[model samples]
Target chain A: MHSPHFSVIFSLDALTGALFLLTAIGVVATRQVLASLQLFIAQSLLLSLSALLLGIALGSPHLFAVAGITIATKTVLIPWLLRHTVSVEVYRTREIDRVLNIPSSLLIAAFLVVIAYAIANPLLGAVDLPFARINLPLGLAAMFLGVFTVVARREAVPQLLGLLALENGVFFAGVAIVPELPVIAELAAAVDVPVVALVVGLLTRQIHKRIGSTSVGRLAALRER
Target chain B: MELAAILLIPALASGFALLPTNRHFAAPMTVAATVVVFILASAVAVRTTHTGRVDALGQWLTCDGLGALILALVALVAMTAALFSWGYIRIRAGHSERRKEQHYYALYNLFVMSLLAVPILANVALMWVAIELTTLLSAFLVGFEDTPEALEAAWKYVVLTTLGAVLALLGFLILYWGSQVAGYAPFTWAGLVEAAPRMPPALLWPAFLLILVGFGTKVGLVPMHTWLPDAHSQAPASICALLSGVETTTVLYVILRLFPVVGGTPSLDARPWFVGFGLLSVAIATLLLIYVRDFKRMFAFSTVEHMGIILVAAGLGGAEAHLGAAYQMAGHAIAKSFCFFAAGAVATVFGTQEIAAIRGLVRFAPLTAVALTAGAFAITGAPPFAVFISEFLIFKAGIASGQYLTIALLATFVVIAFCAVMFHINRMTFSTPLGSVPATALPLSCSATLAVAAIPLVVIGIYVPPALQDLLHAAATAMGG
Candidate 1:
């Protein structure tokens, strides 16, 4: 009996997409700076995995290229850049400061997820792509979570992770809708994301050196009277 | 070839500046490179004025009417800001910090190169990359002073704008998806326009909203503008000129480029969104202008005000309002850059940016006083300045279009912003000097920059050259006028 490749890929891709959204939530919920970074790495890997499966299902070589670029840049180059740019201590930091407590942040995060799916529902109904049924809402939900994480987190490293997760969410949605324009995804992963990490990481080191802490949300020296 | 050369020159200059060289080498090298870029960009603007397009690599690197206008403004600001930086950087760093100054020039050239490439790059994806690079390359420049506050501002600037860029990236990818569904096409603005009508409104609306709100953040629209005042106020004045002057406009150009595409699609209207966000930004900036104590921060908020006016003009519709929008973009760029230079000069002279601290500049520092008052007059829509002409045209266009409520709100905000700006400048100009402040002489290069930047600010208000008027016409028509 021939295997049902369509259902197989759909279920497998749905699984990967769920894991991807989970990692995005993990970033928002985690209190440790190191845990958020790990969650971001896991999220990036899930993104590349989804890209790989979407490439096979869509039969697009362009998405395969995007997958490779995501792994090479996001999981590998970004972490390496962060390691050298920011000190070792920032990664070792356990008590990552955040603007809101975990339950409150997660509550708002849950609200954001519902709103995201509501926003994506109209969009998905307007199009008839099968894979979009899984990716669009999940990716949008993850993006909402990522934005929440950025708003809630107080430290530089966690905040940067939240921003990265936001990007990963976009790309996760992107693979289903724009497998043809792999150039944008590739350029974003290889050129844009790593630079964001390197620059923000370097800035974090400078702030730590000058301000004696990486809790950038605590920075209030530049306010108006 | 010219477009290619324009991008090439600054990339080369950035490399040259990083070479282990004397303190004197970097600034001049950067200035010469921007001069070449300015001349080449002006040629492109002139050619586009006559022929309406210039293509370097078929579709990937091309310039249309609006692109040429933005290119010219960015290049002009870069050249003048480079010249200003020559003396400003030297005075700020003294003889001891040669390495830091060299690094500053290197970053400055790369930053300008990215700004220059934004208009010229035809591929939307690559253009986003260039915009992202503008932030990364300039982060260090924004924090160049090494103060805790400067670093904080830079930290916020990079993180926030990069986040905005990512959100816009998703929007762009969605737009690409829309194009693919309508019919496979290249992912350029022109290609999107061709595909817009057939594209699903479902996809079009989300892409438009995402990009508008996303890049709207970088454009420093009201609610998304918290990072702007800090970054613009903290950066070195020369960098502030580029940041406040063209960087915001350059990104806004990306959002504006979509007007035609969105306008082309059925069941989609971008004007209400534009007018709503535009008027809100203007209103908020006016209120903030009243209480702004730091002169640099005041100029930064004024920038927020001008961006809103341009958005309103764009939303007001018709060729006249669109032309006014184009004029306002040009006028704001020149006047805003000059205002920062005036602020820089005041900072240099009295060693303070607080509006309350410096007084009797007219008596104690006559040259500084003149520059400050003239800058205020030019930027606040006083007579015989580009901003005045542009705002008047915008209002006339708004009235013609019969959007009285929108026009009324905008007019009220502009007037209040005017009074707020003038009051602060007046106190700083003629009021008595507070506590015996010593007014140091402005550096020769900075003074020369003021004279040079003043030319267009003053001339364009009173007269618009025929070729430039044609250029503005082309730019407006390209905006769906």
Candidate 2:
């Protein structure tokens, strides 16, 4: 197999990494739940692209397998499961409110990106990959943003999307740093995600069915009366 | 051969649980599976005491001193939980009874399978996968009723624990990378511990803290333990036993496995973190216990309190403390399972979990009232019970090591928790009958399981069986005693 020059692969991967970060922001910033979820799909797609590029760049075949798993599980399977579980009526009734306003959240997210770069900077010199120093920080930044989204969003679906984004960030960092991470760990995690998605989706459906809304804040009534 | 048998039993049980059998078969099948597992697991525990370790498929599956002890505990509780499920499902409401029973049994087996996998697996990565699977499987069981409360509990459980697991995954990856840097390939627990001294402090310390925080969530450590009470309270009683008694310990098993590795690091101090988190958790859970109104939630908080006690013992870093921690684990598992079973029986009889509504249980269901009282006594570390012995050992170890302030604080909280636990159970069991109390027949399964659990609580209190004592001593050594 003919291999592309190092610079070309690196540029493409860097672009995908950039797009990955942008989609994570899109998820946190979007007002509509469906749009937020759709942005997660976009984030997963970029994650798969980055993984594919890293696989080709590093000459590691397992990253290709990881890329495939990412696409199949995160991109295709999870989105389909979620869309099927959520009714279209949910869209009209639910525009997810943020605990922090969007612009402020985005500002905090950008600050988190700076912290990520700082944390990633020192660790970069120790690893083997040269491109990892560039890609890993963005991955870390995305993770920070995703966690912010989980804590800042009140709805079940948006919070779920936030968790997915966090995972995508972790996966990107995993490939950048330790591409040979055991296939078993990756595969087991891949298989486990769909189960988590299915369970969480079913649970969301149950919450909506009984409570008529998936606002997690409204669940405060369970305490002793 | 025994290791293979131990793993295969649960795997096969999970498969059989999925079969399209009549609803009548679910309980019996589940009971049979758990019984077989208990027997095999006990045999393996005994053999590990004599044999020192059991390995199969090379290092893919291994049961060492610690693993055997934990595996035995898992089986013991799973058996009780399975039996408890028989009674729990019989009286449960608000669902298609047959389908719900079938699904409950199926998920119960799968959950047990993952719990089994946690201790027996040799590789850290595989162990993490197993622990993650336990959460994935049990979160559904937590929401099996599909009520709003159950769903809310399940959602919080999945999101919180899975987030914790992700951090743990990051920790494991870094450990794996560090292993490679140190020239170890497989990243098994043994390999990681061996290579830990050479691992750079930058990698070792962060990985250790990440794992502590990550698995700490699964262990239901404070701040991260918000999901525990809700999930445990909302779940069916039988499932609560496994989740509280077994799953928490199984995940904490990961942290314990990492302890020696972190100890092997040359420059990092690990004890303060354990002690800090342990003290924090105990403090929070103790305060919550005084105000807990829901009986199941009270027990759930007690589980948190017990986890803290065990962690404190481990953090003491004395040989006696490690042994005490092992004994605490066994005692807590038995006592907690018994309490949950009795509470389930009482809830079934009274049709409510509110402690206020449960006045004069003795007048209504005398046997469960007796079991509940005994369980509370045993769990609170009353004399002539297993927890008393373990807690005493911990106190002795703490004093010997000159942790006087921590011990004083521990004693204060223990007394408060004891009074609080006893107060609730006493009011529930012996309070005046507020109205016409029905004389409902307790389920045979509930009574039988509690009877079985009572033996260990009483026996281990007075005398630890020689075989079990051997296993506990060996386990203590495995943890660096």
Candidate 3:
């Protein structure tokens, strides 16, 4: 019975890992800001599901609460806030202007994924923990991809989403390693997320009002004299 | 009595100053509070001189050799800054509202309270949180003016440092994980040091690296130091003094704490990385300082230079080097705070920060001109100042450790930075005033603060107290002498 339960977790972990990779690729390849936001949300949702399944398999009720918070906040509240604050009109009009083209980003993302897998394979093989070795690298790759999105995107919303994605990656990585991190620390982190979201939201409103666009390039006006 | 007063006075005064009443009361109240804290801290240092240590609240707050030195520096400078802000803020009283003045004092107290907490906290995790709280509280202070530029600098500062802190958090987590492997129960400085010998090198190495890079950013090491100049230049001068002087040093103290744990573990030499980053920061900041246009920013860049100096000192990795680093931390706190106070006064008089714009300061404000010149000379490693002694000690340590090239490079950059800074200081002080802005007389508090800050810069150059010597020796010993 324990073995079957482990097998179920293993499959869900694999699916979660694959979804993370896909979302990362989508983040890199997609040039439209709205599409990238959507992909990021999808990635966050998958992370919640993975955390929830792992919690059930491990019989850790706290992780279930973590999962619920992750979903409601990351997948729902944050994206909705981003969408509303960064109005749909702006999202539809502005495409993600990248320094590197889509093909190049995809190629770079592929290279990164390969490097991640190569690094994780031997390391994870030595580790005794279940699913950590695989899940860790996937989470890292998603983080790297999130960073790429942030670097690639010119628009503020996409960059903001990229930051959120990066946090999600870190969260997933933390879950994979120590699924039962002290509840106090976990709650602190959870509380921090929405507060940051709200702050960023306020900043976004200010940015829009001031510049009429939320591009990183224009924000460089305050550089050192 | 000492610890309680150091913590509570600021906390209570800050609470009182936060009341939305009179604009007149804020500055004086803050100054009084800081003075009391400074006096208490000095007494603590004096008491520790005889007893060898001061432990408080069941060892949750401590004044060992290094912490005593830090506490003394923090108290003295914070007190002086508080004094200076009295005159500084008074100049802006008519321009600002009653409420804004109150808010400034409130944030000012909070910032100082958090900085004081960093050196005294016993738990390493608690220390990290306190450092983070310092960032949060000071973020408002940095953006106190709320101008577009100030806002932007504050945002950059908060974002970059917060990111660095998150990495530091991960590093702490990794350390906790490693400690668990080593059969440790609680994660505290004492606990970690006790279990240090058994921890695996793999975990220790990665954790140390993460922490070095993480806290290194807060300390304004190169590449990660982009926010320092902007934020420092934008903040009120008193706060700038705290930010650059004591605040960065407190973060560096945490890195210093980790050295014993990581340095003791064989097969991991963290020195090379520290030296590399130190040299990089020094060289970059030296070159940049030459071209810096803003006088305030020129001072800010010097902070990066000094931090690099301290890092290189620490990287030298010996008892003497550790002592040099400790001395450097103390001296820089005094010298840098004086520099900022003077710079703030000059900025107030000239109504601008541009180096090219402000000239003939001596004719305009002779006292400020003298203070700026003296501060510039002291900070640029001139003789008869504490920074010179500390830098000399560092170079000597570097040479003794066979890091001849590092010492030579450090010297070259120091020279370059000196020339860059003196060039501007000379121009600003000696040259004819560009405009007809009269030399407005400053209030008594401002001159007193500058005098207090300046006296140490001059005195420590010529003499090292026995207690300070003992404290530095002990701190060095704590670093694994």
Candidate 4:
């Protein structure tokens, strides 16, 4: 499988991209809330890995900063915040009721990947970027899948996981697309991610305590008559 | 300095509120901070009216005419809402739950801080973060009631809006990439406009769509407005005032900032999309307002309708149109916040927000009834009200721009929404009482907020203050009119 043309870093990034897509699919397919959270941690890890690979390949310190921050926030801080905030009951609950069944959700998720590539294809053709070819479409696919996960999952933690996954999708694309951004923006973005989790996590705990469940998708009390 | 101080004051107030302080400390401190911010924002508005721009720190902190106008509106609402909270929240929390009140105030200040940050922060990426923070910060405020319903609303609010924000982040990143592709420029609104023409149309087109759909969700554009009603209805009146009033406006401000950037690229046109989505929102919201049973939810739907109208006005194109858009923005903030306050008062008096529950409020709660009636008249675009004038200006501007069809449709929806709102409010206010109720006196701060908010609601429609007129004119020009 070794080719003279493929830089090892590029090949590794492709592998990372593949694993990233897999983790997104895993998030959609998981039944246990804990599994979805675990998948999200893996996905965030994959995201930081890609950032590190891209940072090394592109020789950009900012991507490295992106890598460090994504790990600190998405992987470590978010889970800790959720563990502290969301009740153990939500994680222990199995067989989450989703809007769509897993098999159909996967089929639809597959369709979303095609759509993501179709959407990314034009932009790639429009301007030349070296790494965009690998990262852009895959990042977009993960993002679409993340959105799909959010739609399908009713559990608050998984839903929150879907949201963070969606963000991971954007940064996954961003790390390649704008590698040398002013680290100031990067730092601000870093702060933003944990707050999303903390806020959502705390809200989830409130819902669970008040309503005795975190199946947020099932909430229908506030609609018009 | 004012731009920086406007942000600094709120941040510090939120800090002070968050500290281990007495329960009563947060409300007045927040109110004091907002008063200072209002004065500063007005100073910036006046400065920009004369000078056209105020830059606190290059692109990172800048306020031009449009920014100042939004800043001023947010501050005005924040101050009134803080005042409203002092009385309303105390009543809602009861005397024993002092700590809950303190948390509410702390969250309230941070929420206000996020709204203020949007316009004044010129850097596009940082601006996106600020918009996201608005959702995160306010999520708990929406759930402050800690009811199952409030929790539902807060969850939906955070998850959906944050989803939209994540999507928009990619859009901003693409914009940053486009800027780099064009040659390095700071990722600021001004820099994006400067970089737009040189950017590949492919990049700009997708970025434009992503941001439009993404932030459009937060802006409560229909199909994406589901969470808005829930959050706005479920939140306390003070928070509702900010949520329905300036919070939505502040997010829409971000989407509107894209207009000039998208305008610079010759091959790209965001107008049709703007008008399309705007019309759709207005149409749907008008329909919802018709069947809306809950008064608070009714006001919330009206917010969606008003957002649509402003989006349509912005897309209608021309100086008059943009000016109308600016005017409508100001009018909606003032009137909508008033409507929410009145609704809150009615809800408190009657212990329900349902339209069917209250009848002949005038016979019983005359003061609350009168405030609700006035707010209703103001929001539904009654003659000599700011909404009517701004919407009128928009209609005339549409004719000038030759977008007769869009204007006609918008006019029709606006009228239907007006009738629907007035119809329900009319029944709530003047109709004969179905049941007898004891007379009630509203909290002092709530009454004071309504009276103070009413002044601008009445005066702006009748008289256009010269500096405000100049500021609106400058804002319209900044909007690419």
Candidate 5:
């Protein structure tokens, strides 16, 4: 009875990790702003699913709380905020402007995955958990990819989304390795993330209004004279 | 119960700020509430000194000597800022700015409430939450003016600091994992410190490094310090005082909290990293000072410089050095806030933050000119000033610890910074008046606020009160003295 449940949990965890990597790729590869936002929602949903599975497998109430938080904030609230930020015209037509083109960004992301695996290889042997071995590498890769997205993106909204993506990766790693992390911390992040989204959205809108563009490259006026 | 009041009053005051009645009474109420918080914070500090540590609310809120010291600093700075705001806001707020008054005070109170939470939190994760709260709360305050420059500064502050903060969360999570593996429950600082000696070096080193780089960003350590000048320069004068004087120290308190835990790990020293980052920040900031054009931006860089000094003192790793670090934290808090208050007065009267735009403050406002000059003198570590005493201790500690090279380099950078800061402020205060300076009188509240800030700088310089000395010693020991 336990073996079958364990097998199901293991497969679900693997699938979640794979989906995390896929959505991460989709976030960077998409050219349209709305499309990138949709990919982020997919990524967050996968992260929530992973959290839910971990909660069921471990029978921990706290993991279940975290799962609820990830879904409530990331999957539901943040995407809505991002969608509301862009008007219909900009939403439909805005190019997800990037410092690097899609093919190159994808290539670098794959390189980061290889680097993550390399870094995780030595750390893996020290841990006895079977699931962490798979989850940790995927989490690290996603983190690297998220940071890359932040650095490469020129527009404000994508940078915000990239930061959220990084948080998702961190959450994945935390759930995999330390499922018993106090519920308060997860709840704080859950509370804080939406507020951040609200502020960033507000700022992005203001930036658009004042400067007539959301491109960060145009904000070079405040530097030292 | 006092702790509950300490936290609740500011939050309540913030709520009050939005009410119509608060419009006429906001400044007075803010000052009154902050003074009450100051009294409560001193009581907690005294309790911690006598007992060594206090845990309340079922171990959720913890206060050690370190917490007490930082708490007192936050309270002290908050009070001064409130008093300063009394005049600063009155002068700055006009017809167009009337609607922003409520928003400003509300955010100010919430910001203070967040800083107050940091020292009291026992759980590392919760502490990170409090620190992140400070960043989020103040982002709006930083960009309060809503000008293009202010908005840009606010965006950089939120983005850079938030990124650094998230990295800190990752670091804490790793430590949580390590603590669990070592058979301790997660989240408690004491538990992690107790389990530190048994933890693997690989896990401990990465955790420590990640935390250093992470919190170091908020501390305005170089390379991650791009946001500090912008945020500080853009925020209101009183808010600038809080950010420069108290906020960085509060964040540094987080790094020092981890010292005893990470210092216990056998294979990791963690000192070299601190020293390297500390000296690098100091050297870089000093170089930038010579080229600084804005007085507020110059003071902002000075904050980065002082943070480096505190970090290096702590990083030197000796009883003397830890003690020096504690004193430095106190002295810099008092002195830096004084600089910001004075600089704010100068900017307001002269109607520009640019160093070149204003001259002969003495001719325009004799009293403020004198206050600004004294502040500059104290902040530059001039003799008989509070900062000089703390800096002397730090130098002595470095010599005792045989960090000869780092010490010599540190001294050179310190001297260069002194020269640059003095040169800039002297031109602004003592040189010929540049234009038809506005004849706005410095309000009595502003003068009183400057005196209140100045008294500590002089008093602490000449004599360390017995209670303050005891608080410093206990705080030093808490950091592995």
Candidate 6:
């Protein structure tokens, strides 16, 4: 009976790890800005599930509240507002100008994963928490991968989505290490995320309307004297 | 009582000013509100000399030596800027509308309230929110004219700074996490300071860098200062005064508040980084200021340069340098605003911001021309001005620290910037008229505002009060020099 329980716990941990890995991959592999947005939403949902499972296993009620707020804001309201504000029809039809090809981006991401592991391995080696040692590298890798996505994408919408992905990676790392943030701080962070989304959404619309495209390259017009 | 008067009155008056009243009433109402706040802030500064501190709002806001000094500076600039706005907007209203004028006043009050809240807020997160609110509330004001260029500058200002602020948020999270690891309960300023020694240095180091760079963007430090020239040049003169004077200083105050938490860590030496960035900013800004085309842009670049000076002073990390930094903040607040006010009056008289297009300003408006010339001299650190005194002290401290190259470079760049500003001001004031002269002179109110702005620049230059010097020493000591 004890062996079965241990197996169940091990499977849940593996599932959580796989979800993080796939989200990082999806963020890199996708070329379409709209697809990137959708992938970011999926990544947030997966993060919510992982946080919820960790909360249940640890029996921390505050974690449950955080999980719920994360799912509600990240998975639903922010994406819905972003979709409407960004004009999906424009992003859907146009192809994103990738700074690096998909294969090269994926390779770079893999290298980043190795470096993250190299950095995180010794640090987490002494940690006593279950799965803490393994998840640390994954969390850091996801963060690097998210930043890579931001650097690779040409369009503003995807760049923003990339930022959100990076935030998600950081959140995962926070949970994996600390287990739970103070409720007030968590709420502040959660509220700040959507406010940022709203501002970015508004600016994206304005940029598209004025410049006819949301490419950051066009923003180079304003330069120093 | 003084704390409540400094903070709460403007917040209350903000709501009242937003009400539907005669459009002409808004400006005077805002001015009255500012005067009250200014008096209370002065009282607090005076009282705190003897009492040592003032607490209010259930201790959520307190005015210590550092906070009191900044509060007094903000109140001083805000009041004069408010008076200037009254005349500035009244003239603008003749071209625009009463309703639009009311909106400007409302946003103006909101901006002041936000700046007033920053130094007083006791919680770190609450302070961040207040600082972010300054950006949001001021965005509309920055683009108040609604020209395409104005709107574009505002958009860039908000987007880039907000992005930097997100990094700051991550920094705050890291600090909170570090505190948690050290077994602290809540993320308050008092709590963090008490728990600082025990917190892990690894976490605190990254958090410090992130917050410095993050807030440094708003402070107009090099590489992140792209928004300063555009926003300051585009906005009206009153708004420019607030932007260059109080707003940027308020953000720097946040970074200074965090110095104690991370500066004490043995492995993480932040001074070199601050000095390095400071020297770089000064070099770039001085070079850029030499070639800048617009007078407003020139003044804006000077802000970047002065901010760099303050950072270098603070980074020197000693009693004397920290005192210099405190004094520099107050001096720059007065000098930069006076420069902007003169620039605004020049823009009004000459009907242009382009350097080449404006000439013979002294021939046309003598009072404004003298103000502009005086402002240029003061800002460039010429003799008998507060900026010159503080900047000299900074260089003295830098030399004492054995940063010989930094001192030499700073002196060279400051001279370059000085030449650039003098070049423009001389051409505008002394050169023959290139365009048609204005039919009417500057209004009494406009001249009065400029005079009010210039007095502090001249006064602090001649003498530094013992009480004010004591306050400066206290603030420097509190910042962990």
lDDT of 4 by residue, B1-481 (tens): 8888888888888778877777778888888999999998999999988887888865468988999899999999999999999889998898898778878887888888889999988777888889999999998899988889988898889989999988888998898888899997878888888999999999999898899889999999988999999999999999999999998998888888899999997787888988999999999999999999999999999999999999998888788999999999999999999989889988888888889989998888888888888888888888889999999999998987788999899999999998998899899888989877754568888888888888888899999899999988988998998
* Candidate 5 Cα outliers beyond 4 Å, as residue runs: A1-3, A83-93
Q: What DockQ do the predictions score, one after another? A: 0.76, 0.58, 0.24, 0.90, 0.61, 0.24
Q: Which stretches of candidate 4 lie over 4 Å from their true place?
A: A1-6, B19-22, B438-440
Q: Pairs clashing in candidate 6?
A: none
Q: For every model shown, what is its TM-score relative to the native structure?
A: 0.98, 0.96, 0.89, 0.98, 0.97, 0.89
State each model's TM-score restricted to chain B.
0.99, 0.97, 0.96, 0.98, 0.98, 0.97
- lDDT by residue (tens digit), candidate 2, B52-120: 888888768988888988999999999888987786677673345676777777788888988998998
Over the true interface residues, superposed, what is the Cα RMSD of model 3?
Answer: 3.2
Residues forming the 10-long window of minimal summed lDDT in candidate 4 chain A? A1-10
Query: After TM-score superposition, what is the CA distance of residue B459 in candidate 4 from its true location, in Å?
Result: 0.7
Q: Which of 3 and 4 is ahead in lDDT?
A: 4
Root-mean-square deviation of Cα positions for candidate 5 versus the true structure, in angstroms: 1.8
lDDT of 6 by residue, B277-310 (tens): 8888888999898888888989999999988988
Off by over 4 Å in 3: A1-4, A21-103, A115-127, A154-161, A187-213, A222-225, B1-14, B40-64, B90-96, B438-444
The alpha-carbon lDDT assigned to residue A112 of candidate 4 equals 96
What fraction of the true interface does each of the listed models get right, in terms of native contacts kept? Answer: 0.79, 0.51, 0.03, 0.99, 0.37, 0.04
Number of the top-ranking candidate, with DockQ as the measure: 4
Supply the global lDDT for candidate 6: 0.79
lDDT of 1 by residue, B1-481 (tens): 7899989899889889888877789988898899999999999999998887999866668998899999999999999999999999998877698888888988888899999999989888888889989999999999998999899899889888888888898889889888988887777888899999988898899999899888988899989999999999999999999999999999999989999999997689999999999999999999999999999999999999999999999988899999999999999999999999999999998888888888888887788789889988988899999888888999999998899999999999999999999999999888777777766878888999999998988888899998789889999999999
